[model samples]
Target chain A: MNDKPLPETLLPLEVDGVSFRHRGQTLLDDVSLRLGHSGKTVIMGPNGAGKSLLMRLCHGLLSPSAGSIRWADGKAASDPDVRGRQAMVFQRPVLLRRSALSNIRYPLALRGMRRQQRTQRALDALRHFGLAELADRPARVLSGGEQQRLALARAWALQPRILFLDEPTSALDPAATKAVEDAVRAFHAKGTRIVMNTHDLGQARRLADDVLFLCRGRVLEHTPAGRFFDTPSTPEAAAFIRGELVW
Target chain B: MVDGNPFAKALELILGLDQVLVGIVTLSLQVSLTAVLTAALLGLPIGAAVALYRFPGRALVVTVLNALMGLPPVVAGLAVYLLLSRAGPLGSWGLLFTPTAMVIAQTMLVFPIIAALSRQVVEDLWEEYREQLQSLGASRLRAIPTLLWDARFSLLTGVLAGFGRASAEVGAVLIVGGNIDGVTRVMTTAIALETSKGNLPLALGLGIVLLFLVAMVNATAFLIGEGAKRRLG
Candidate 1:
């Protein structure tokens, strides 16, 4: 759906020796990974395994205390061009205290999209996500499912090259989870790269192209979805796949 | 002995629509409203800035603002009087003993209250909105309008509190306006004057009108807040 040519590609995200510390405690320790220009990569780990923290680091929400995260074209995350090409949806769906339409319109406005064009794009995104009727409703008051979908709609309006989902459906019911998963597939179908975190193995199996398994802030495995599930490389990964607590 | 009940007389004066009473009421509204509008215009941005930015002495500034919210009206009036007196720095403009001087005094008294309350509201909102706005590429400065607009309902209560302070205080307006007849005279000063002169009926009427106006302002704010909550929620 993105007819306009991109200014530059932002793929092949390279995380080099990235580490994060908080209050003298290291949360992510010497983590390094390379993401190429494709696939829905699911980050699976037990609680407190630094899955969300690592995603946030890659999305530029939080800076690493050590090493660097670089895009393929060398644009810094602080650059507006790079920021304009990425979006993140938090676990709780941080909707604005505004109408659903305005929530979608806000980022477009920040990107300097014209009023008429932004409104048109926002409406198309809402319609695409099947939220056309609730466009005028206050975003914060919407049901959990609707709010998450609206969050997706907002990200969709941005036409992000990469989308980060941090446990997006963890708080939703089964029906809502299904809707979010479908929306995630929709984003992937449009050629947007997806990086997500989930504790739900079934969800991981359904959506993951590759799985990155983590235990205690260390990456134990990064393999294709099938191989990672069928034959985990590390003891931690094996215990995790067997539904035993590893952390 | 007074001629009749003060309440009955107040109702009579109000129902009769006496010209002097109307003038006093009109002038009181003009001065206080002007003061509130001016204070809000200046204070809101200051409050938002203090909430969003972290500079040296920010904590001290916030503490000073909170302390200033309790500034005595007479002290504020005296401060303005000194600034506007013949020997004072701004005396060249000769605004002393005028309606504008009264407005300045009241605005001075009200600014701190608005600024402090708005700072608290905006700070709380910023905490909730920080991550989402940052992710959207909005700088702290760019997020101001959104934060302010979202905090509008709470800010309205702060403005009303400012209005209540301005309309109720006689010390500041009296010192600055000199209670001049048909000129700088307003409801609070006129009430004080008529009471001392044993013109109890007029004083009581002004008091009743002032109370009614304050009630109306509060009711309107409440209804607006409730309506928005229901509709938006």
Candidate 2:
């Protein structure tokens, strides 16, 4: 797999009639949406709206109880080659007890890469996030913002084709939030597909090419950024953007 | 008319026949050490596997091992005794009343404890660390071992505990070892036999030594546990 033509493979994603429920109450109900390549798709929804569940389903973490999710390149959700080309950052990053460089090198080692190549890749990743100074520090000891940055650095160092983030910066302080936003924009500049969920409308406007507005286990609309904010197609989405307690 | 205090007289007996007492304790040490090493080798990987994978029969294996964790020591001894008896399959080895038989019974007694605790430690790690590694493209097998390394401290403490339990228990060794002097007799059995024969001083001395041994094992375990906490913290 050559890195030719600068991001040539932009496989779209398809969700076909995916449905999930718990104890008779639906969490995601027959949801269908298409994710195009080379753009940020921000998932915006109110609390208890199942936005995170949708992200997990997309990233192949949760197996949907009904229907099927397929990639645009006709790969099934369980395919390792396809899944390996994607990465995710949770709301709170999980760092290993080892050093920062070791954390970055973990996935590479899992792929059976040789020791010297693994170390080089890890060093390159550390330098990218300005974590080179702390390469030997135990990853669990980094500050909240630094950990999230390191998590992003590790994910992106693999050059994954798609990155799914579940409110990655929702827990950070304002200063840290800016750092994470800067990282996200850098990845965006690299033409990596970004699918993210956030409650902050300001963040959505800054990051999204299109908005996937969700409410109560349903997709309210798939509207462009400008129209989604100014003239939401649904009453629920408009209320959510305005912080009017859609729930 | 026997004695004013059995423990007091037992101490005298232990001091008088110091060689016998020493021999018993030495044999106990050898057998228990061997059993624990064997248990760790056999048990840790199986425990880790059950904790990290979700295949068919996984739950059943965990449940059975958990049930075996409380297996009575004498019952384990009896089970092993039967297997190694003349009429049983393993009788050809002539191991029915030997130190080897005692080791096997003790292994049976504490193998479950090591395995069960190891499973608990590995499972806790799997629950917490699986998602992060999976997101990083770690295969299930690789991710599980990494999780085990994260919980290395707990696994170490588990082994120490297994050692203590195996070395200190009497019921299993008493049944399978036959308590033959200079051949199968161990510290626990000698302590019991000397007491029954109204040997108070030797029994008291051995009892004190046994207590000291337990204290040392626990002290070592505590220090190692603290060291692990510092490294991982």
Candidate 3:
């Protein structure tokens, strides 16, 4: 589903010795992994495994207590230009108190896009996501699934080089979950690197090209999607895949 | 100039558009509106700045502001009176008994309310939108307008609160203004003077008008807020 080639400058995200601590508690303890040039990478682990915290640290929403996160072979991840080329969707959608269309338009507006251009881009995005009819409604009032769709649509409108999702569909029912998965697949097809985290192993199996299996704030396994599922490396990963409590 | 039931006399003056009443109303509006505008101009940015950034002494500033929200008008008036009074530091300007002095007093009294309230509104919105806005590539400065616009309805209520404070205040305006007839006398000050003179009707008249003005300001703020909510939603 390649729509356009990704910019060469965006590839090969690198995390090295990154650790995050808050109030003397280590949330992510000296974890490091390299995400190669392309494809959808899913992070899976039991609850409290720091999956969400890791994504936020990578997304630059939170600074790591130690070490660094880099993209494109040592390009600082937190640089505004780099961050501008990226987007992150939280578990619960964070929408502006604006119209559905305005929510889509806001990021574009922030980039100094002209009003007319922002309007048209937002409209195109809404239509692309099949949210055109809900365009004028306040984004906050949308049903949970709809708000998630709108959030994804807003990210889509930015044409980000990297899209980060933290449990994007965790709160959705089956149908809604499927819809979000479809959107994620479409983004991957469009050549935006997808880094996501989910506890749903079924979803991980369906969408991951590479698996980053974290447990208890440490990386227990990073392997190809098929191999990670077929020949589980760690006892923790195996226990997790079998739906046993592994923490 | 006339005697009888003060309420009826007040009505007659109001209905007859007494020049004195008209002048008083005009000056009251001029003074209070100016104060509100000045305070908002000074307060909103201060509030937004305080809410959006972490600086040294921020907690102390916020605490002081919260405390100052209830500053007595008399103290504010007394302070301005001191500042602008003859033989005082600012006495050379001779602003002590003028409408400007009342505006200055009201501004000092109400600035904290507008700033403190806007700080709260912006702070709440900042919590909600901070991550979202930052992810959108907005710097703290860039995010202020967005947070302020999104919280405009609540901010407008803050403005109305400041307006109410400025308009209804008597002690500060009275002490600083000297309640000069046809000069610095506003509705509140006029009411005080007229009541003390046993001119109950005129005092009652001014009181009614003041209440009406306050009600109108509050009603307008509510309607605008509701209109925005409905239209946006």
Candidate 4:
């Protein structure tokens, strides 16, 4: 982890009253939240609860049909600087059809980092993720766990201020899941705000500082991980905690 | 008809290294390869742009390109011939009845095939890669090279398909090249000329060679594509 502070932090992400509609149907309705510059925040919900949709809206991959998402200093997610300061990892680990080293170097190159420096940083990232041996190998051919780890290493190379992961370990085995969780912890330790979406209650309990629970398209509860787990807040959440299906 | 079996004579002509047969084969390869190269240079980017960008009339453009993939070689040759004729728009170059003119005609005939096939290929790749590349801060323009590179093997098959069209067509080259004895007599035009002149053995020999060449090109492309797909994926 680079201990050097980012020049400007895009912290305190404020998503206010955002609604996303597709065709005639609403997918994420009146989603609102504020996240400061710390801790792991996991968005937990049942299937089709709009957890992934909300994260996409916040990450600027999809725009909300209604309201706004602003970072620190009122910068919109569309701001290039804000976008440059954040990174995302998808569930299936979308690695470029290139060597693992090049996959890590790609975003750094896009940020206009010079060749030598970006290569060194990419190599360091690969080493950090225990992927140094796979550096020259094509990324798409790697085992699923290694590919996801490479995805994390690629994110690490960016040194993002916030990392959004959408069910990143949904397809992984237990060992691979542990590796991804450890990588998430390392990112949080380096002060990168972690906003993840997952339906796994055990994972949320293990990693979330605050849990944003949703049922249908609405946020049911936004409570600390402890309280969200211990107390019965919403019936949907309680049912979810008890391993029962909601919606 | 020749006295011996046509296939035996054709095989003998090929193995005997007849100068005329070799020359025609070489010129055929040179012209078609050059035309395919030119078409790829122009068509790949055009296809990629069509795939990546959203503009007015995009559907119309795609439709036209797809339709043009089945364009008649003679029609393409006639268009080039008209352009290069003495009183036509590009007549100042005096490129009529030349190998360059054949190259131009074949390029015209092959461009749409390459472009339309590549558009389909790059479009599918773009669909798969769009969100991830966008997340990495890659604009659509910047993503073109990456998409093209990642789709290289598939695009190579497109280029080879264009080459196949160019090499196998007789009408385009015959019209523009005038089938001149040494200067512009490619295999297809020579086969047509020889057959019309009642020289069955020579025409059959050229036909055999042309079939072999096209088969070899396709085989090579398939092997390379499969090998690289395994290595990269």
**How many clashes in each candidate?**
0, 16, 2, 0
Q: Go through the candidates in order and give the C-alpha RMSD of each one to the true structure.
A: 1.7, 3.5, 2.6, 1.7
All candidates' lDDT scores?
A: 0.90, 0.83, 0.88, 0.90
Candidate 2 wrongly placed segments (more than 4 Å): A1-10, B1-27, B52-60, B180-183
**Chain B TM-score against the true chain B, candidate 1:** 0.96
Residue A224 in candidate 2 has what lDDT? 82
Candidate 1, residue A7: lDDT: 49
Sorted into a CAPRI-style docking class, model 3 comes out as medium
Candidate 4 - CAPRI tier? Answer: medium
True contacts kept of 2: 0.47
Q: What ranges in model 1 sit over 4 Å off?
A: A1-3
DockQ score, prediction 1: 0.69
Candidate 1 local lDDT, A1-247, one digit each (tens): 3448464478889888888899998888889898988899999999999999999888877899998888887766667767778999989877777899999999889888889998999999999999999999998789999999999999998889999999999999999999999999999998899999998999999999999998888887889999999998898899998999789
lDDT, residue A127, model 4: 93
Reference-based TM-score of each model: 0.96, 0.88, 0.93, 0.96
Clashing pairs in 1: none
Mind giving the per-residue lDDT tens digits that candidate 2 earns over B32-91? Answer: 888988888778777888887779988889999999988888899999999999998988
- The digit string of per-residue lDDT tens for model 4 on B1-233 reads 54546678768877899998888889999999999999999999899999999999999999999999999999999999999998899999999998999999999989999899889999999888888898999988899888888989889888988999999999989888899999999999988988999888767877887898889988988998899889889
The true-versus-predicted C-alpha distance at residue B155 of model 2, in Å, is: 3.4
Order the numbered candidates by DockQ, best leading. Answer: 4, 1, 3, 2
> What's the C-alpha lDDT at position A210 in model 4?
96
Per-residue alpha-carbon lDDT of model 1 for B33-63, expressed as tens digits? 9999999998998899899999999999999
